[model samples]
Target: MSGEWQHGLLGCFDNFTLCLISWLVPCYQFGKNAEAVGESCLICGLGFLVPVVDIFLAIHIRGKIRESKGIQGSLIGDLLYWCFCPLCSLVQEAQEVGGAPQAISMGRE
Candidate 1:
């Protein structure tokens, strides 16, 4: 029983990081407007961390949701692979693309 509790705790933590990375990546990539971006981050955080899966929540954001279901609530997220796998894939791609054996030569600054 205690072991199960610990596992659950760890799973929640994993989801938290998933939310953070997923929320931040697109925000940084798109350079959205400040107000909307801030609001979106807060909203996504709530859904991701809580494990509530943020079903069709129309009232909280006070706007019609572009899409309601969260990461785990969706097909991919339900597969237990939030975004870390993609991040790992990106790193793998980088390593493949002349990123391996990278040597940094320091020059006089």
Candidate 2:
């Protein structure tokens, strides 16, 4: 695995649907990202409803993702991303872990 994010923080528009979802329902996107890394989707999704806990959860899950995927990043960077551009960060994480690769089919034909 590459020691880098599959999608850039500002590359949310790379997948318009995911970007829109991340914008329209941030909690859901966050939950999905958390779930991808074995965290409780409902707990994380509901945690996003809170103010302070949301940032903490985001940072925690981002760290889990980075560790699982071998992506290079720091907690401070994760904090900055979640604090400044949460939607973009959510979209990036979703793209990195949620979707199947373009060359493969994850769904039944």
lDDT of 1 by residue, 1-109 (tens): 1211112212323344433443456322111211232346455434434433532221232121112212112343323322334333222222222222234789877
- What would the per-residue lDDT of candidate 2 be over residues 1-109, giving only the tens digit for each residue? 9999988889988888778888898888888888889999999999999999999999999999999999998999999998998888888899999642244568898
* Local lDDT at 11 for model 2: 93
Error of 2 at 52 (Å): 0.6
Candidate 1 global TM-score: 0.21
TM-scores, each model vs. reference: 0.21, 0.88
lDDT of each: 0.29, 0.88
Which 10-residue window in model 1 sums to the lowest lDDT?
Answer: 62-71
Prediction 2 TM-score vs. true: 0.88
lDDT of 1: 0.29
Stretches off by above 4 angstroms in model 2 are 99-109
RMSD of 2: 3.5
* Winner by TM-score: 2
